[model samples]
Target chain A: MQPLVLYVLDLAADGAFERCVRRVEARDAVLSVTDLSATRGDGVFETVVVIDGTPQALEEHLDRFARSAALLDLPEPRRDLWRHAVLTAAADLGALRPRAAIKFVLSRGDEAGDGAGTGWALGFAPSAPPAAPPAPIDVVLLDRGYRHDVAQTSPWLLQGAKTLSYAVNMAALREARRRGAQDVVFVSSDGFVLEGPTSTLIARIDGAYVTPPTDLGILPGTTQADVFAGLRAWGEQVATRRLSVPDLLGADAVWLCSSTRGAAAVRSIDGTPFTVDDALTARLRDHLDARKK
Target chain B: MQPLVLYVLDLAADGAFERCVRRVEARDAVLSVTDLSATRGDGVFETVVVIDGTPQALEEHLDRFARSAALLDLPEPRRDLWRHAVLTAAADLGALRPRAAIKFVLSRGDEAGDGAGTGWALGFAPSAPPAAPPAPIDVVLLDRGYRHDVAQTSPWLLQGAKTLSYAVNMAALREARRRGAQDVVFVSSDGFVLEGPTSTLIARIDGAYVTPPTDLGILPGTTQADVFAGLRAWGEQVATRRLSVPDLLGADAVWLCSSTRGAAAVRSIDGTPFTVDDALTARLRDHLDARKK
Candidate 1:
């Protein structure tokens, strides 16, 4: 069946440009598109760096995706089959324009049946974080639509998976817009600053870099891990620690790191502006570039 | 567009039932179907009791659905619109067995949106838990999955929605089956017995019944609340308190309350068999029946 609607999107909210085709599935269509907003969010996703028409970190991303699937007790996707699919999708976008992002989603196919025919879809989402941390990205704190804290026993399923239950992410982004910010940072109801809706947060405090502890259940970001490792090797004191908004607002520097955006320095928090250390920002950017190449 | 395949079944793991469906989406001339599994393990779900073919608690269910949606940071299903759709779907069921079970799933609909129109399928799976909890049912104490204690935060996104992310629930059920039991009970990593995968747990201790506090982030069971209120009016002491497996195993009686099952008494814990108190079960069941009518 031809999809009900298909459109080429010149740009997605993430600022990454891409062409997308949408198909609407009937309520009872067994083999059609399933609406993702209704079920418990259970799925794993991978974002790979596409540079010069090749996917970097494909293997690592796949590994993390599988780990996420296992963590959520989801049936692991066939490695070779999915890898081939990923390669095909990336290759489809021939002649990459210097840098691009590839997103892979592996979800439980459909909830209608016994959850068989595990569904898999791939979409090319805009992946680049601001080439340079937005000269000053505005951020707001709001009630997270879901729990981002890694330390609590959550009743809702799909805690850490790159699940499609991303309505909250979009909502948070919308909230950011409402608050006159390009993005929003999440704080636990208890007052501890967690992470951004989409990126792992790193802050410079007293000349040291810090992130939330991984055991807190934050998504173990590939980019965050790499940056932490690089910073540590460079004799920089980097660590993961609990942080509050006061801590972040008072930090020497703040940045958001993700697969697409290596590291974006935060310019303001709650409308309070901060100075971006040009030397430190350039060093982080250079580190990301060197690693990418 | 006619859905290629349709099914209605309860969200329980059946070792003997292996049914697969090729869920198809109708798009003009393009018919695409994805295979789905038959497990309801990791997702959160809501069971709205329908009366006269019209779903009662539509707004409440939507409210809970939104709360559940917020827990997972799920995308908004447009409360009124989705509520209407759910009512319509329940209405289509045509008063199946009077107290109809209307379940809406918000899982990662499909995970292959590599822009080929994959990822996320909203599905309405209608089914029932066992007609009733068996009197004097057996219980087991098992630790099969990661203990999501308060010390650890969920690593994934939207850790608190009622999506089809139910892998652990399935595991607990399987564990019960392995021990010759019909239903499984979960305890928190901290040894505090949580609710059953599908039911709210209550125990009568020293002539007073108590349930876990909702602040622990457990699913708020509608039936449990009704029963609690009813039991209280009758001068029975009912309170919300923290309970452990040992406490439940030693209580006068333990019960599992859900939308369809109403209430059922546990006869034993782990491998130790306990006697079913028909008197108490009947009392609670009668109270529920009175409230339902």
Candidate 2:
């Protein structure tokens, strides 16, 4: 296995990347207890998968990163610096394994320090590939306790931004596991189907790939976008729309899409069995793995 | 100003504290990039005020910390060990200043490490006391995006627990500032008054002290509890009930209360003026500062 790689980005007063970015030992403690990232989860992060040394969907990830920062009112991330860091880390880890992931983080800095924010990139390859045959996931629907229009009605609640404050998301996942499921799909209070705790939900309904719209206070799905593009190229229909539980139940197939893990078929939701399309799952995996960018 | 103080708590396999608590320099980096506290905000925390070499409301803070951990499904914090650590840090910090605070944290440990969790205690005194006459705070009522009964209907949302995922709270404070206010009192989606982003709301209504019930998905305020006890001793009425914006607008007086800052009178809500009860504010502060436990 390849050793983990880390780079600490030096940020300027205005939060732009400075010239000196230091490569640090991954085992060293690199964060102060007072850093808002550690103390208050006041940060934003993006994880990009690298296939054969190429960081997949790199620009889209960066665009979403900047968007998240803007939503959180943090400084704009320097794209050039972040790109360099991702590519450098990918190359280092991709040499040891064909598959790797790089996570880049930007925080609101120390509580008592100068105003410059804290930023870092970390790259590592999984110790082993997932189980053979890519087991389908069982998911339970959990209440997210927010209305579908909360992102517009109350921006301070930070519904759409992928901030570091993910404790509730983690708790929901644990709740799913307790109920004999491996994953969760959050439902808004007003009966709209939202995204997964860590992935995007795509349901094939009436012969079209449908995902909940981002305006429903959920993340803009990057992997789902790539999958949609691939589906479009293959002459299949795709869409962004408001999804409800009934719509999901009536779908032909359902899957969760994420960067590193690609797509995983949903075998059951709340114990209602849904047939997994093995051939389609395999095709999507191959498409994702063959990304050149 | 005195230098900061820090202690790293060692944990056993079952997440109980071990005897080898090491005091490290406050400036030293003490957390890994992969600690769940930083990566996912998967943790709980509590802050206790230390006055004149004594930690105030120590047991209550510890109880709340343990309750928060239970909510997050983290291990029960060993009370004896935490008490000792808080006292040790508080003593070190209290020797330098009459008013100081100690924050104790427990995280779900490094993502790649053994299952044992990470824990720390940090003590520091403000460089200077707050402005004389204790300027009252002008607050705006912001939507919390959760219904008042969220804590009952959706425990996985982790509403009442004092978790480290405070980015929304911080953002709400920023929104208050953007709207030309100094602080915020979060209101529920279904028209109920909640707590502040970082403080509890206490209103004097109809000649009685009233606060929202904890069942409304809010933290049970430690300072407010103490103030209630003091008020009871003074032969004043105190009650916990659901509050509304109109209730606040019509209240005789209002205040935001926290452990370290004691209490700050609310001078206004939104743009409407509310006269500050200087005598009551001073009395509450003195009553809080006089705690010996």
Candidate 3:
């Protein structure tokens, strides 16, 4: 399998993308060493699925990307330029791009001096989705160490913003993997169920599908949003609330939703099993598939 | 006046330093776009000072760097190789290398398929420090949103590890700046004094120098450790305690200490002023200077 195919956005001659897409070599100079992304973990990024040669929910991803950049006080991302880069990347992958992930990154440039930021669009097909029925994911509950209201009360926490500082998120996932779990759903220190390291927590409880509110400092789940809309259109009740670990355990069905992975049903958490609701899972999976643009 | 001088450590060909140092251009690929540090912020780093063309406390910094890598479950860094790179970088800086900061970075390589990691040593002199009398800084007290014991109780928190996921720290500094303060002292959610965004906090109280312990998830300050040893040898008492916000505001003096910036006295926190203890600050500053090698 080839490594990441990075397409540099040529912002020369007064910052214009005269050349739209070029393959970035491994040793090529694509980023300044002083980029805050490298130095301070200061950057924002998004990974979207390229479905059948079309980027899925690219505008939403860009919207969220811009929001993240804004939170970091970075200049507004040139959305049209991003759209072009994403489209070129998706198109370059040709017919095999279905289910490929297109990563968009914006870095805080060279902070130690030498002025100019960096942006890139990378396209790569993810390894074939885990053995059909998407294999129910075993998860661990980890503390996020922030209160549910921290995003609202403490703006500096950068809650709800998808910044590049995902070390904690990655650490939590590694911890889960170490404990023989495939995933993790972070619980607030105060005990409210939050979201997954790279996904959003959603579950079927009391005839309604529920997701934790993003006010808890979790990134708003784009796939979850699309799923809720699809479910609502199907005459089903979809809601948001403060959830608990026990609530997840007692739910009829639970799933972690994300842009790339889509609907991954949670079978167990902290090694505790819950009977899988195959019908509910299939319904949500179908709805999620139907929602993809 | 110049950009970051990134000395790449080529680990291919049996982990040998094939190409010792190369001038990494602005657009050069010092890192894979897919490097987890760029993608998921999965990495650890250290910034040590170079005095008279020699990196000070290189061994201590390497020890902490190794500790951080362990906390991240990363492969132990090749310290001898890192030392080679650091020396080459400092020597490359030539006669004016005094007080330059040498940053060492280790990233969890490409997350896609490539398994090799990336390492670099960057040397650059920092901007000139502020004028003498040192214009005591105004600081803001921000909540870090975790109990001080989170490190002890939660192994996955990666507490006290100096990982590159510093977005929160950078944001806190920006928040402080926006609030008309020059720096920040992060307070634990449970009302205990933690540390600063980029430095450790210390205060002069009851004729003893005190700093919040690292068990509180604060990065163990190498400079603080050096200062404590120096002070103890000078017959001054140094202690560790769970301090409160009021402890800082009421102290004879407070300082934010780090390797590069040394010790910067706090004049005010959240608009509350503290009388500067110049005599005490000078004593500690002199001790810190003597300890620097």
| Two-chain DockQ for each candidate model | 0.11, 0.70, 0.61
**Chain A TM-score relative to the true structure, per candidate:** 0.77, 0.96, 0.91
**Candidate 2 pairs with clashing backbones:** none
- Candidate 3 error regions (>4 Å): A1-4, A10-29, A113-116, A127-129, A279-287, A290-292, B11-28, B127-133, B279-283
lDDT of 1 by residue, A1-293 (tens): 11211112111122222213222332223332332212333455676766655666677678788877776556765666566655654565435355565655555544444454343333343433444444657777654433444334542334455554455565567668867888877776456777776788888889888898755556777788778878888999998889877888888778888777677778888877766777776777667666642
Highest-scoring model, lDDT: 2
Worst 10 residues of 3 chain B by lDDT: B18-27
> B164 in model 3: Cα distance from truth in Å?
0.7
Task: State the C-alpha lDDT per candidate.
Answer: 0.57, 0.88, 0.79
Q: TM-score for model 2?
A: 0.97
Best by DockQ: 2
The sequence of per-residue lDDT tens digits that candidate 2 reaches over residues B49-116 is 88876889999999999999999999888888888888888888877777888889999988877878
Fraction of real interface contacts that model 1 preserves: 0.10
Clashing pairs in 3: A28-B28, A28-B29, A29-B27, A29-B28, A29-B29, A30-B27, A30-B28, A30-B29
Ranking according to lDDT, highest score first: 2, 3, 1
Which 10 residues in a row give candidate 2 chain A its minimum summed lDDT? A12-21
Per-residue alpha-carbon lDDT of candidate 3 for residues A1-293, written as tens digits (9 for 90 to 100): 24445688654323554455466653344665677777778889898877667887778898899888888887888788888888877877656544677878888776764445677888776555546677888999988888888988888888888988888888888889889999998998888999998999888889899999877888888888888887898899999998887887788778898987888888898877866777767777767655445
How does chain B score by TM in each prediction? 0.72, 0.96, 0.91
Compose the digit string of candidate 2's lDDT tens values, residues A1-293: 22388888888633434454778887679998998998899999999998878899999999999999999999888888888888888887778677788889999988877878898888876767777568999999999999999999899888888888999999999999899999999999999999999999999988999999999989998899999988998999999999889888888789999997788999999878887999989889889888779
